[model samples]
Target: MKGWRAFLLRRLAGTAAVVLLLSIGVFGLLYLAPGSVQQTLLGIRPATAETIAAVQARYHLNDPVAVQYLRWLGGVLRGDLGTSIRTGVPVADMLGLRLPLTLALTGYGTLLAALAGVPLGVLGALRRGRAADRLVVTAGVVGLSAPPFAVGLLLLVVFALGLGWFPVYGAGEGLADQAWHLTLPAAALAVGAVGMLVRFSRAALVRELEQDYVVFARARGLAGPVVLGYALRNSLVPILTAAGLIVTGMLAGTVLVEVTFALPGLGSLLVESVTFKDVPVVQALALLLTLLIAAVNLLVDVGYSLVDPRVRLGGGPS
Candidate 1:
C-alpha cells in the first residue's frame, strides 16, 4: 500500500510538472506568433496610444508575459478558462458543448477497433501459415499504410456517391442521427487503430504462448481455446497500455475527421480558434487536452495493477 501510494504521488507530481511546462510553452508560442491580437481583431493598426492601451487592457495583454501566464494558470486552476476573443463566449461553455461529440466519436471508434482487431489478431496467430492469416496480414498492412483522410475520401466515394448508403457530410438530425452519420468517419479513424492493435496483440500473444507457464498449461490438458485465452489475458497489460496511448492519437485524429465531416466537435472548434487567433480559446483547449491525456494515462497505469496480480506484486515499471 505504501509503495503504491508513493508511486501514485510521484506520478501525480510528474503530471503536474508536465502540465505546467506545456502551458508555459503554449502560452509562449501564442505570445510569439506573428501579428498582434489587436491587429488581427481590428483589421487596422491602433495608431493612438490610448487605443493601444485600451486594447491591451481589454485583453489583459498589458501585463508582463510572466504575469499574464500566471493569471491564465491561476484561472485554469479555478476552472475559469476565460472568454473567446472571436465569439465573446466562455471557453468552458464552448468546450462543455463540443467535448461530448468528440468523446462519442472516439468511444465508438475505439469499440469498433477493438471488436475488429482482437478477433482478427487471435485468428491470424492461431492460423499462422494459412491463407486466412495472409489475408489478415495484408489487410493490416494496407490499413497501416493508408492515411486517414484518404480512407475517409474512399469511404465517402463508395458509401455516399457510389452506393448512397451513408451521408457525404454533416452530422444527422439528432444525436442518434449523428451516430448514423458517424459510421464511415469512425470506421475510417478505426482502420489504423485496428491494424496497430492487431499487430501488437498478435505479437504479444505469440510471445506469451511460448513462456513456460503456457507450456505447463498445455501439458495440463488445456484445450486450444483455453490456452489462447490464458495467453491473451496475460498479454492484455501491454494492449491496455497501447489503447491508452491511442486515445491521445484519436483526439488529434478527430481534427481531420471532424473537418472532413463537418462535425461540431472540439477539433473543429480548435481549428476555428487557430484561424481566428483566439488565444484564450486555444490555450484553454490545449490545457484541457493535456489534462485529459494525463488523467487517462494515470488511469491506465492504475488499471495495469488491477488487471495483473504480478504487476501489483512486482511493483516494477508500469
Candidate 2:
C-alpha cells in the first residue's frame, strides 16, 4: 500500500512537471510564431502606435516572455484560461462547451474500435493460418491504409448522402441525438484504430498462446475457452498499453476527423484558433491536451499493476 501510494504520488508529480514544461513550450512557440498577437487583435486597421500600445497594454503583450508565461500559469492555477481574442469569449467557457464533445468523440471511436477489433483479433489469433485469419488480416490492412479524413468522406457519401442514414453535419443536442449524429464521425475515427488494435491484440494473444503455461493448461484437459481466457488474461498488459496509446493518438487524430465531419469539437476550435492566432485559446488547449495525455499514461501505468501481479509499483517485479 505504501509503495503504491508513493508510486502514485511520483506519477502525479511527474505529470505536473510535464504539464509545466508543456505550458512553457506552448507559450514560447506562440510568442515566437510569425505575426504579433497585438496585430492580430488590431486586424486590418492601420497599425497606429496608439492602437498597438492599447492592444499590448490590454493583453499585457509588452511583458517579457517569462513574465507572460508566469501570468498565464497563475491564471491557470486559478481555473481561469483568459479570454479568446478571436471570439471575446472566456477560454474556459469555450472549452467547457467543446471539450466534452471532443472527449465524447474520442471515447466513442475508441469504444467502437475495441469492440470490433478485440473480438476479430482474438478470432484471427485462434484461427491462425486459416482462411478466416487471412481475411481478418486483409481487412485490417485495408483499414490501416485508409486515412481518417478519407474514411470520413466515404462514410459521409455512403451512409449520410446516399442512404441518408445519419446526419451530415453538426453535433446534435441531447444524449440520444448526439450519439446518432456522432456515429459516422466516430466510425471514421475508429477505422484505423481498429486496424492497429487488431494487429496488436492478435500478436499479443498469439505470443501468450505460445507460452509454456498455455500448453500446460491445454494438456491439463481444460476447455478451449478456459485456456483462451487464461491466455487473454496474461496478454492484457500489452493490450491495455496499446489501447492507452490509441486513446492519446485519437486526441490528435480528432483534428482531421472533426474537420471532415464538421463537428464543433476542440479539434475544430483549435483549427479556428490557430487560423486567427488566438494565443490564449491555443495555449490553453495545448496545455489541456498535454495534461490529458499524461493522465492517460498514468492510468495505463496503474492498470499494469491490476493486470499483472508481477508488475510492481516501485518498478520491480512483485
lDDT of 2 by residue, 214-279 (tens): 899889999999999999999898889889988998899999889988899999999989877798
Q: Which predicted model would earn the best lDDT?
A: 2
- Model 2 clashing-pair count: 0
- RMSD each, Å: 2.4, 1.7
TM-scores for every candidate against the unseen true structure: 0.91, 0.94
Q: Per-residue alpha-carbon lDDT of model 1 for 159-255, expressed as tens digits?
A: 9889999998877778789889999989988999888878877777878988999999999998988888889888899888768877777888888
Displacement of residue 1 (Cα, Å) in model 1 is 3.3
Q: Model 1 reaches what TM-score against the true structure?
A: 0.91
lDDT of each: 0.84, 0.90
